[model samples]
Target: MPGKPNPVARLFWTAAIGCPFGLWYGPPAFAATGLALTLVLMRHLGRPRRFRARVRRIARAHAETLALRRRQESFSDAYGNRIEDGWLRERAYFLDRTVLPQIGPRFADLAESERNRMLAIVEAEAAAVALPEEDEAPGDGIDYERYCAERLARAGWRAHRTPPSGDQGADIVAVRDGLRLIVQCKRLAKPVGNAAVQEAAAALRYWAGDRAAVVSNAGFTPAARRLAAATGVLLLHHDALDDIDLAGAHRS
Candidate 1:
């Protein structure tokens, strides 16, 4: 009756809605019919290879994103460690990344000395507030490296601790009197040895600086003195500070 109630249409509607309900029940007919229809529709909509390719592309993109994030995190960790080390070399390396990028490409063409000048201004502007107290006893000869930095700064030079990995013997670097100089400071109570002079000479060669100097509270040994003279390394005795202005130079 009623033209058999359009059996195909009735079955289609039943399978469409009833398949979900069949999940809870035991109606294999509704599920099978719906699954078969879905497959037919997908086959007509697109080629299987195309769909598979799209899925593969998405997977590859996700992998690349993950790899990039990992690399960034690793770089961040290394940078943090370098800063925490509190070495001049470490600081330079970190600043090269964070500070250099902002000044743009013009800096790339500058020589090492010129580049250092630009960096000094930037570093000075961001100078940190020192702690309230001094760490060492008064007049107990300053750490030679720190002492040189203080002295040069007083002389209106921009001084910074340089990396010591292959330093050759230079402990500090400074720009002074329109010249860039590499300095080796010795805090011994006695005269420095010729070996130290050799080290300073090596450092000068390594840095290719305009000049090199050796500063020691303890005067230079005869051998050291001879080498310094022969090699053109400026020598400064500990008592030399009495003759120079050290207002901004490091103390304690």
Candidate 2:
């Protein structure tokens, strides 16, 4: 495989081609050949760089395409599972079978190391593609709270739902590894705001818990994130309940 075209080699070829035409057609032909050579050099010199950029664009497109197809398939399944994990798992296979064929011919003359570098670019770009977020939550707020509690229980936490009324802003109370956590569950179409963060922080103090978190199906507002950060409260996606780090949560 060939490496990038050398500048000296390009100049040599330009002269080789132009000299013959110049000899036959005088100074006019020589000047025209020089101009054409300049344009060719300008464009062809960046071929490798342009090719790498093209590879990144193609990789992202292929990744998004695969994610969309997986999401569509998930709609028909009983669980309505998230497609992000599946997309990541199948990324390499999809790239080899679909993405490579479209761009592989261009890399035919690249050195093995250069080819590997290009593949690395493709992998990074594909990995950077954002998968669609899981938007569907349970039917109502109470169910959503219960759902979060159940997920925490499965993750080895001793978790239970608080009473529907007079719970003092805590939807769930979870304990694991000698740390008690107060969680406020919010299931809303819109993003959770600073009020939820405030509520969770207050609940943590009220319950005398070590840590506090606000778990939501929808994302949190910027204000909420800022408030959570200031109050040492965690604003989390529901999926993150599975891997709660008790010691880490207390420190943070």
Candidate 3:
């Protein structure tokens, strides 16, 4: 036989089940206590969500949570690629996963200057890496020269590729703020040497330009760096050529 119900449970069951029926036929006290307790417990546990609309309403209120989900989307929009694990990819991911959560929906509520400062960190970190290699760059000389010109133009310098012949030694001529710059582009797999810098210095004079620079897709040798410094020519490696700020030079 099943064990007899305990006294406490027996009384609880009496109060719980009898309370409702008591209104119709059971004793007043049982009905009153049972019905009251059942209602109270139901309220405490809360009713099951009545419909999907309630869920939709809750999701709409969490705008910060929604914005954070766009991290990969923002990365793709800016960089033309998906997010991944590495210095270049993870740098922006860290900011998005960590700092942006704290800023949340109130991000736009902050003062303009503070917002710009915070976002500048993200944008710069997003752009700091991911330069293409020389082997990955265009093979054609004219195409490579055009590529360099386009890269400088994007970096806020007005750059144009020089004519194939009788263009002095520079491949690109960039001007900003009345300053003419003779740019020597050495698009080779080998690291650039002092020879490129020397050429830039000569081209600076030959082109009657106020400034000179040597840009290469491979990077500069130590000798090239030293000679560039001595000759007052700016030496830009492949990475620097793409990401360097020419607007600062324009201001100077």
Candidate 4:
């Protein structure tokens, strides 16, 4: 009994070997052993909870990253581009691909918390990306864009200003009822030319916009109007702005 350990002691030494026992002795050794065993047991018992939390964090982070990439892509599908709506771009993509369908006719409900959480994410990401400048419509180009955005918003669109430097061709993005329309606004004293319509068509391809348009406060050149008709790009002149329907643009 003095030189050889009992069967129980041998099992205690090895059964849960979390603590270093050889260097410990007396009641202190027993205390250390108990604490070690408690920790090991707690870890084993809480594994599922830890795993769930980790998975949730990873999923949220992944969603955020994808949203950011999408935002960048709007600027010529690269970085360092000028402004277009930062928020609507991200929100619309998720809304179309994920949110709308999941809650529809599934017998499943979108909890209020889930909706709020999504908004929070979109807002935070949008905010992190700085607007080109604090100044509103720094020049003629931006001024026309601002005008177009206001009119579009009044027409029930969720409008976003595309970045100027990296605009893939769209000056403003108008979204309504999950429909995305890319618009190029011309603030020239003369009529907008055919070039405007061509640029808008190219932008539609790059942005995958449902419809494209060239909007002018003045008027569109005859060539521009014809090209728009052929290419299916809407031409919004000052007089026709009143008759244009924002909701209908989404369908086009």
Candidate 5:
């Protein structure tokens, strides 16, 4: 107001600085004097209402971006949950001998190889159908254990036969292309429980390698799968191994 320039005030300030500089220096110095004058011109042109509106618009845009980011994270978490749950339910249905049609389209949409893998998991659960109790011996658990390890070996892992020796939770200690992997093999006729998962996770710390895995002929329960996922263990069902490519196994 009284302190600074309006348009008329700007012209007056310009004339004041330029007139003094021109009287002392030359008109060329007037150009340098104009710079300081431009500042006064800007103050004269300033409209508080328009400036506040622009600031409000910018703040609204920033808030919208933050909201969008939060929504995206929510969607991501939901998608992950859906995938895990789908896998868990489908696995259980297949093992229970529920018809494929009853299992829904998600299971139907699986590729041929993936379907075979899932079937293998179901087949592993078919312990009642495959091997007899009278035919089984004390160490016969090694056969299924080997089957699990061989499947991993096929899938570019260097799998070893480390049968459960009753000392620790893990059954196999494998290395895939130099990264060490510890795996516990559970040959169960029924669904695996959370206790087995917790035991395997605890044994992971004893592993001298990079990863820990738990494999079961009978698939893991949803709670067990969640625990395995949270702990970074590869929770594999026996059927999952059917998809492994054993010939090109990577063991470094």
Candidate 6:
């Protein structure tokens, strides 16, 4: 397709065409030509600004997509086998292969400040997806449940600890965007077992929740992970709670 007309070139052509008519005719002709030129100028005046705004919106949307991909990849790795420096390597590869190629050309016309601002937006989004540093477990399982609830609350979920004794299998119940998540929290030295996964899955049905998850300070046993996969129960590190997508969990 042919490219759009250059504003400067269009202005020059308009003036070139109108000048002779104005000279050949009288004041009325001159007034009409000037009005036409003004209208043309007004039409193109905001084109660059609008184009830049569109580019910024595209950049932000791509940044958000990259963040989501990173979170999903991290979640998968944490579930199965976590590799050292995996996230850093994955992020570098994504920026080099995906983000730069897609957004780089669109940014060519943007001013330095605007370009920098978009880059900052991308970095901020990526940082948000980076998992929180591991923290010491809370004093007891109840404290850990409360801690997870607080973390979920910060992430926009209305989360609270379930009642102690007869709360079924759910240690925490969180609701967000009309999705209810039943979580079984385990503060353990050993890997969480199949029982936790079983409880979380059962709790989801018993509590009429949209999704179920088992959050733990320790890793999950292979059997528990398999059971969770079969039951559509999320096996998450407590640190991963902030990045959970309630809708995605429900679908899973």
Local accuracy by lDDT, each model: 0.53, 0.71, 0.57, 0.59, 0.53, 0.69
Q: Could you give the candidate ranking by lDDT, starting with the highest?
A: 2, 6, 4, 3, 5, 1
Question: In every candidate, how many clashes are there?
Answer: 1, 0, 2, 11, 4, 0
Residues 7-76, model 3: lDDT tens digits: 4564576566765676667577655776676675664334222112232333334423333322212222
Q: What is the Å distance of residue 79 in model 4 from its true position?
A: 40
Angstrom error at residue 197, model 6: 0.6
| Cα deviation of 173, candidate 6, in Å | 0.7
For candidate 1, the TM-score is: 0.39
TM-score of 3: 0.43
RMSD of 6: 10.7
Candidate 5, residues 94-199, lDDT tens digits: the string is: 3344434343343333324345454444433332232212212123467767776777787777777654465377777777666777777777545467777777
60-146 per-residue lDDT for model 1 (tens digits): 433432232222112112133322111233235434654445434433333244445433433333333232342231233345577
Candidate 6 lowest-lDDT run of ten: 69-78
Candidate topping TM-score = 2
- How far out, in Å, is residue 63 in model 4? 53
Error of 2 at 157 (Å): 0.6
lDDT (10s digit) by residue, model 4, range 1-252: 232224455446543563455245556776777776666566555644543343334335446444443343232212444434433444655545555454343212323324555555555544565433322222377777887788778777888999877887899887888878898887654556889889999999988898888875445555876787788898764334434664453211
Candidate 3 ranges beyond 4 A from true positions: 1-136, 242-252
Stretches of candidate 6 exceeding 4 Å from the true structure: 1-134, 247-252
Residue 119, model 1: Cα distance from true site in angstroms = 50
Best-matching candidate per lDDT: 2
The candidate with the higher lDDT, 1 or 5, is 5
Model 3, residue pairs in steric clash: 15-34, 19-31
